[model samples]
Target: MDARFLGITELTEVPSVAVVIDVMRAYTVAAWAFGRGAEKIVLAESLDEVRALKAVHPDWVALKDGPPAEGFDAVNSPGLLRSADLGGRTVVQKTTAGTVGALAVKDASLVLCAGFVVAEATARVLRRRECDAVTFVVTGEDGRAEEDLACAQYIARRAAGEEVDAADHLRRAMESRAASELTEGVREGAHPDDVALCVELDRFPFAMVAAPDDSLMVLRPYAVPR
Candidate 1:
């Protein structure tokens, strides 16, 4: 199996398997949500779609670009999801990169959303499946963010049976602008705890797989050995 790393811009070139990385917060939050027993997470490409979905399914939790709306369970923050009771509930998520990147790879034979939490499981799955080609989509803000790139690299190396230093990757991500926004409280609706949560590599022992449910893509957690 061969693995290739690319940013969200190169989502057109479909591979046998695709993994979308968003270490800053999106996939990190998703891991926490699944850890808390979330049934399924719906990935919405736009905030408008999130709202429309919420209108029909009021019980669904919605997390959009900015701060979460009033009465919503939580924002797109991993720390916030830590305290949420999402058991048996569906979450509607719309992010700048993660969800958008996941939706863009419709042609991929298999699609998975991941972060530091599920890096090992993702790598294990790829090797077990023996995919001919795998694409690691680093879903960053404008183009490629340090945190996402580092996560993608880590997964790629692990999938290729290489030794990865998790601490070094975390150190590099902490120095990134994306990490600084959460640490320095620069980005609106961002919490310092969220940054800390996102950097905890291999925190979860499950990988999120994307499956078609009617007209939407639902991310469902599949447990893997730690």
Candidate 2:
């Protein structure tokens, strides 16, 4: 498959498969939710929608951050999600970067949300797809989120048949201001170990694939071998 690297601004033109990346936490949370055996996750467009979905379907596990509302299950933190009992539950996720990136994608047959924790596995999933082009949507537009860009490039390189290790990319992510915010408690509700958790490259053996289902962008963990 031909690999295309683009920022969120260029999401207007997508092809074949698009991998939306948010390494600071959103996709990392998706990875941990799957690792916790979550049945599926529904992406919400706004915090209001996140609350509405939970209010209507109280059984759904809602996750959001930045504001840390009263009703959500937890903030968008990978450290918290790592130990969450999400098995057999539907996760309603709203985020600043990852969810927005995934929702912006148009005309792509497959959409996969990714982070460093699931980067290599995502690449493997992309490699197995019968498509002419694969686009990596770098969801980190904020000055602090260089990590998202790093992880996106890493996944794209791996998908394009290059032999690469994730260590270099991980280091770059650690140095980003997003990581600093997590460590310094600048990002509200961020877990203490959030940075460390997000940088654990290839921590999951599955990829988070998002698809449209009943008006919700449903995400499920698709198993992929390392």
Candidate 3:
């Protein structure tokens, strides 16, 4: 199926496979960690619980979700991942929107984590699988952001086997006239670092999928690490 973009509230009504984007930090960092050789990423709804998991797996790496204002690691900065030496560790991640979407879409036929950094890879995966119906669940700022829309459209077009005209998508996706306008939203409470990270067309080959349990699900594309 062709991939489409849906707002979080619209997710419950959509029947297509969901590719959730918490790009500002959640999915972006998850993608970065996986790309950097992290074995897996455990997405948690609660920061305290993430820390608890870290306590048990002390050797595993951990990062908390702190937005730009809070001065915490609420969103994993791309620069941080790019500069760190992750090697083969597993990263335990918690975010306001990314993990929350993971928990919310626990029942989707196939729940995949995506971001601009991994958009091309994600599109390739979807096309290879030939999913009958696909949708992008964009976890926006309080559930709103143009970055999510742009990424989703990029994937959606790819899934449809349509040629991607970056310029066209940017013109339509942004609120203002130019691609530069999209970045302006970042200053209005959106994470500027995240905004920058999400705009990176394609930077990773790894994908993050939900590993379902009962109440919550974790975002890790590969097998869960011990």
Candidate 4:
């Protein structure tokens, strides 16, 4: 199997399987949500879609830019979700990087969302599936966030049957500009705890897979083979 790592902007060619990595927040939060019993997470490319989904399904938690809407449960912060009661609830997530990158791969045979939390599980699944070709989409904030790039490289290395030192990757990611912003509270709506959680590699034993369910793209957890 051949694996290629590319940033979100270089997604001109879609592979048989695409793993979208967003370690700074997005996919890390999604993994936490799933671990906390979230029924499913719908990936929205735009804030407008998130609002529309919330309007139709008032019970769903919507995460958009800036503060969360009135009566909404939370924003796009993994730290906030840590205390949330997402039991049997659906979450609608719209982020600038992760979800956008996931939506861009229109031709991928399978779409998987990844972060440090689900890195091992994602790699195991990819190896199990044995796809002829796989692409790692590092959905960095703007151009190429260091955290996302590190997480993507970790997964790529694991999928290629290499021993990965997750701690080293996490250390590098924690020192990145994106991590600095989140930790120092420079980025609005970002929490330091979110960055802490994002860098905890292999926190979960399942990978989030974006599968088509009717008209929506639902993120469901796939348990990694032991």
Candidate 5:
């Protein structure tokens, strides 16, 4: 069962467990949000949707996402997150790829947010659940980014019961970007600094569990508590 992989359009079903990945920045920001003690995070696919979510959850924080030039409330860059004043607030985030992917897989039995920043922790969470299926939803820029596929392969290798070689995985992932027809402008908007920040494996000691309300619940990195 773990050998299977699926790409989804909308998150409407729940599997026994699900692993959501927004590797470029969304998941990284999510982790940072928790680290800063934010109460929760509501993920939306579009800027309009995020604004609407914020309207109702006024106390909740809102992040607009898009290319840097377009200027979304929060750019999908990790460097920006590190400085954000999330001392005590909930953030509603929308991103080019990450958040939307998260919204797509809402139906999974359990959704655990992930990225290169939290890959090790995420994998540990998966082992603890021992679910019948684990889905990794990749968020791509304009619906296409080599990074997403690289992340998928990384997670897929882990799910396949193979050894996960971080260096090798990154190399493989980067190779696609090198060959991609996409432009530097689209890729650079994610920010090189942000990419570096997000790709630091096991940097955080926590895993984010998605709540019924689509917000996240922070859990210790190792496993779930009884």
Candidate 6:
């Protein structure tokens, strides 16, 4: 199982299997939300798309970055999902990098999203797929998204059957500039504990994968086949 890493710009060239990673609270928040019992998550490409989905399915909850906006159920934060009773409900999530990168993948036969919280589980599932080359999409295509690149590389290494030090990966993620902003509470609607939540390596036990559901890509946990 060979693995390759790509920034968001290279989405078009991705192979049959790919994992879109957003460690700085996008896919990390997604892992937490799934662990908190959200039945499904719609990785929407835009805030307007999220609103339209919510209108069509009022029972579905919507989450986004920063302060609360019109038609959103909550901000994208791990701590907030802690007490959220989202069991049997759908969640619509839209973020600048993560969701956009996911929506941009047009060629992958299988698409997954990841962060350190779900990296190991994601690799496990990928190993079983037996794809020729698994691509890790670093959602933060910008040069400074150290955490995203690190998480993507970590997952790629694991998928290729290499031993990795989880603690070291966590350390790199914690030291990123985005981590500083989150911990300092300078990033809007980000709680101090959110950064802590984001760096919790392999916190979720299942991998998050996506499938086409109407116009939305439905993301949910994928367990090892029984």
Q: What is candidate 3's lDDT per residue for 4-102, written digit by digit as tens?
A: 566667665635478887656567778777777776677776767776776788876767654443323324566456556667777777766777777
**lDDT for each residue of candidate 2 in 66-142, tens digit (9 for 90 to 100):** 75678988788887778888879999999887888888884479998989888878888877775568777887764
What TM-score does candidate 6 reach? 0.94
Question: Which runs in model 5 stand beyond 4 Å of their true positions?
Answer: 10-14, 56-59, 67-73, 141-145, 156-162, 178-183, 187-190, 214-226
Better-scoring candidate (lDDT), 4 or 5: 4
| TM-score of structure candidate 1 | 0.94
RMSD of 5: 4.2
lDDT of 1 by residue, 171-200 (tens): 778788898888877766776688888888
What 10-residue stretch in candidate 1 is worst by lDDT? 64-73
Report the Cα lDDT for candidate 2.
0.83
The residue ranges of model 2 lying beyond 4 angstroms of the native Cα positions read 142-144
Residue lDDT tens for model 6, 49-87: 888989999999999999878788888888777778888
* Residue 158 Cα positional deviation in candidate 5, in Å, after optimal superposition: 4.2
CA lDDT of each prediction against the hidden true structure: 0.83, 0.83, 0.65, 0.82, 0.61, 0.82
How far residue 34's Cα lies from its native spot in candidate 4, in Å, is: 0.7
Residue pairs clashing in model 1 are none
Clash counts for all predictions: 0, 0, 8, 0, 9, 0
TM-score, candidate 5, is 0.76
lDDT of 1: 0.83
Better structure of 2 and 4 per TM-score: 4
> What is the C-alpha lDDT profile of model 5 across 1-226, one tens digit per residue?
3633344454345555666666666777788777767767766656776667667766677665555543235665667767777767877777666665665666666777777666666666665556556666655544345565566667656645568778866654445552232225454445446656666776777677774552543222233332
Q: Among all windows of ten consecutive residues in candidate 3, which has the lowest summed lDDT?
A: 173-182
**Prediction 5 global C-alpha lDDT:** 0.61
Q: Count backbone clashes in candidate 1.
A: 0
Which regions of candidate 4 are displaced past 4 Å?
none
